[model samples]
Target: MNAPTAVTRSQTADAVTVILFGAAALVVTAISTVLRILGTFRDQGIAWSIPIDEQPIDATVDSGAASVEGIAQEAMVFAAGVDPVSTAAIIGSLALWALAPLIVIVCVMVVAWNLLRGRFFVRGNARAFDAIGWTLVLAPVLIVLLENVGLNGVTAAMGLETEGPVHPIEFWSIVPLFATGVAVGLIAAAFRQGIRLQRENAVLEHDTRGLV
Candidate 1:
């Protein structure tokens, strides 16, 4: 049996790495955006309230006869309202929201920069590959972030709550941060892999040319 070629291993590693990084970047952007929005709402003073059972009382007439009384009350109540905003925090949050798109753009720019810098699996077409890679990564992150933010605001305003240990708003806020981290790692891996594959291909091409 023939030995495994360096080119094959390099290509495989590069492809896998690129895939992982790209996917991770996408996921992180999505998750973080969502979580941030939810957190904002939670911070705004929206909350759930469970009703306390009213105790029964007996009323006695002059004759000493007791009459039972019953009253119905809501089992649960949800209080939704905007939190008092500090000038600094409000400004900061607004700035953060405004700059979110920029963050996504930067991530994409990095990918593009890497590709154009001859860091990806492109032969002679280095510039084009970089541009394409950057675009692919940029679009999704922006869309997901924006959507999550909008959804979070709407949900909070509507005063929706679920009966469980975790609140939907809270879950959305925290879970996305974790997801975003995973995504960042994945995208990084993809970039690394792309670089590796590009190098491997170069060497293989050289070898093949020499043999011919």
Candidate 2:
């Protein structure tokens, strides 16, 4: 029994260590992206990368042996030479990509660290999970709103002849955003239940001493 329990603990520690290492690497990458956002201003004209799949642009690329995931992942709207992208669009796009995920990851790491130390059923842990869920759901709303405003700036700056305004967010995106939010919310709900039970058990033990 002792041997098995020890083995389980050792494995869990190793897994958590690996997770922390990977999370650190991601945090570093996100910081690098933020730094690149600063570098964008030094350019003669701002270079913005919009997904080819998202934009209705006539473009193609020869992906000979390289395998790319998602539709038109390798293709991007190379409009830097045409006109400069807006400051709001530039910052909004990077923030939407970098800051939103960064916030969620930091919250998860804090909760995970506490759970490993057998300090899981606390109000703080529940709030952290709650934050994770809401951040996943609402961060996009604010960031994307800013990004859309920036995109419109690009449209007007370029003087493009369009039948109507551009649609930044599409129907397909709503599915993943909704699904992810719900999954995180369920985890938060579980944590809240754990905290409630822990508090109730503590009260019962104190009131009815030696009975619990």
Candidate 3:
């Protein structure tokens, strides 16, 4: 309804700075992940793990022979000589991790920067929110799907027989991201509605003030 106050703009600028710092932290994490993956390709394993079974068990896994111990609901499979499919899958997985957070953060930065400049209800900000929302929904499932492919391929490469089919839907992976994505999507929709209502008002204000 009205222009953002200077106080509001200052707060948004501070928020943008904090968000930039957060994004920087995420970048460091991504770089760390890439380094680990590089070590794996060099035959120094990066502790690349895949799901074993849903049952409770105790295990000590070494080389190939695993001595079982209970460690919650999941178990780890130590693997080497990763297959081409598995390598590709791991690369894809890394890309997803690096890219998803980057996308969401960049979108948030866009919105914050716009608000800091005293512009709200911009269409570009709506698209930013859309990018964030959709990436959240899709990235998690895709990451899991890629990992499963790698897991299966790694097992087959090593001539290990799996207990059952492993390609079923991973609801555990999808749920959290899906929930977050839905929430962001709702926000995106609201942003779009704001744009529809205020774009004309924005135009009139600018025309009256002779401001860009």
Pick the lDDT winner: 3
Model 3: per-residue Cα lDDT at residue 148? 73
Per-residue CA lDDT of candidate 3, range 52-151, in tens?
A: 5566656577864868656464444556677777778878988888788888878888887777767677777889989999999999988887777777
Decide which is better by lDDT, 1 or 3: 3
Give the better candidate number (1 or 3) by TM-score. Answer: 3
Lowest summed lDDT window (length 10), candidate 3: 39-48
Q: Residue 106 in model 2: shift from native, Å?
A: 0.8
Using TM-score, rank the candidates from best to worst: 3, 2, 1
C-alpha lDDT of candidate 3 relative to the true structure: 0.74
Q: Which candidate is the best by TM-score?
A: 3
For all predictions, the C-alpha RMSD in Å is 15.5, 6.3, 5.6
**Pick by lDDT: 2 or 3, better one:** 3
Task: Tell me how far the alpha carbon of residue 172 in candidate 1 is from the true structure, in angstroms, after superposition.
Answer: 5.6
